[model samples]
Target: MKLIEALPIVLSCQNLSKSFRGRHKQETVVLADINLEIRKGSFVTILGQSGGGKSTLLKLLGGFLPPSSGNVLFNGQSLKNNTPDIGMIFQDHNLYPWMTVEQNVGFGFRIKGEKPGNYKHLVHEILDTVGLSHARKLYPHQLSGGMRQRVAIARSIVVKPTVLLLDEPFSALDVQLRRRLQEFLLALWSEMNTTMILVTHNVEEAILLGQKLVVVGSNPGRIVEEMTISDIQYRDRYHPDFLHVQRYLESVLEGNLKEQGDNYYEEVLAISRIQKINS
Candidate 1:
């Protein structure tokens, strides 16, 4: 295994920001000055509340949306536009209803104008890698939520993009299924060595998957805290250090409950004002 520090930065974001037009015709900022670097083959996870700008950041990195300020760099070039070097998987399966699992997995290659025969072996290999070999002929509707997600993952990774962006990919699965898929993804990452950025609301999931965990908040969504999980003892989620970090993050989000007297109203009003303006 290559030392983490020796891995080159595969993606970078500098002073990234985004805003939406408010109902009052003012700009409601969702993110501001977001700077991040994803090392080659590293897994970075962004975790936040439901309304936080996690999804927006993911979209920006994936080239699905333009940043209001700053730039995203892929390799050494500015990501001023979309490119095939990035691939994304959303919460939705997003497979063509008419296409079989094999076809969907090969869709990226097909769109690139590659002949089926050229990518046929690769597609089969990825399907098996994702443990979906038995259901290669199934369609989206014919599969369970977990299975569909596996197909989506297969599709994204089949192209072997330099970076993979995922937005809550296993959010719809049951607890057991989600855990299973998480293990599968970690194993797959070990084998393929792909750089990945995942946006999720699941704290445990973030802790388990990320080499670094970024906590984001809404209303000019900026990173509030970044925790390195490299030393986390994953085998014992209940370990003292693990619990301590979890509690720290939870407190960061909920604020110090004991000090909610005079400052509570101000914080409440700040949130309310943003919502009223955005609404």
Candidate 2:
């Protein structure tokens, strides 16, 4: 999706870094000197290899974890820790099985001590946005995996946070379901105009869903490449540009792996040459 215009800034990060303790007590850096700026109402997807700092970065932004260095800012305010302005959705629904769908969606308000009568209307509205209105009374166990995920999404969005952090939230679904939910998410984002950052290893999804695509990898997870996803018309997945972006992203991801022996590097160079030729 090529952006026709520059969007307003909704979130920013500067010199963000994080590290974990290794088995030998060595400091294992997961993210290093990361910097990012997220436009309000934009969809930003982070594509990275497994064990990369993609998830860790998401957690840091969401305030689920503290960054080792640098700063995260939201709307000129320092994000020293978690703020209600940020909402998070994980791969696991994390829905309370005992709570009904409506109850789950309204849980955030409840935690803040708001009366049910005050937020009940909003809960229903957000549920409808995710196409879960009819399932409002259903428990988590009574819903399909996709439906459960929708509930999770509704719960996060009901409060209308400025930024939404998604950690491979759709990875558990079937391919078709994943695509459907992707479209749903874009639609919701359009309607709500919420800034969103998602972590995923899926190249196609990253290219198709993100206006700004970032490739991250570890040994201290840092952004290796950042590219604007232009030329996507969203008309069809089989479009030439779509396939081209996917191939490019796949090649980049393959290059980030630990097994990039000489043969692998040569293969990658060959693929790059071929893609350049085709382009």
The best candidate in terms of lDDT:
1
Candidate 1 segments exceeding 4 Å error: 1-3, 22-25, 257-279
Segments of candidate 2 deviating more than 4 angstroms: 1-5, 256-279
lDDT of 1 by residue, 1-279 (tens): 324455798898999999988889999888999998888998888988887888888889988899999999999788977778899996565889999999999999999999999999999999988889999998889998888999999999989988999999989889999989998988888788788899888878887788677889767688877655555363356876556556556665665634546565455445434432432
Quick one: how many clashes does candidate 1 have? 1
Prediction 1 TM-score vs. true: 0.88
Q: Clashing residue pairs in candidate 1, if any?
A: 30-221
Q: Write the per-residue lDDT of candidate 2 for residues 1-279, one digit (tens) a residue.
A: 324136777778899999999899999888999998887778889998889888788888877888889988888677877888899997565999999999999999999999999999999888877888899889999999889888998899899998999988888889999999999998887677688898888888887788778888667778876766544343257986666557666777877434445575455446444433432
Candidate 2 residue 72 C-alpha distance from true site, Å = 1.1
Least accurate 10 contiguous residues by lDDT in model 1: 270-279
Give per-residue lDDT, candidate 1, residue 110.
Answer: 94
Model 1, residue 209: C-alpha shift (Å): 0.9
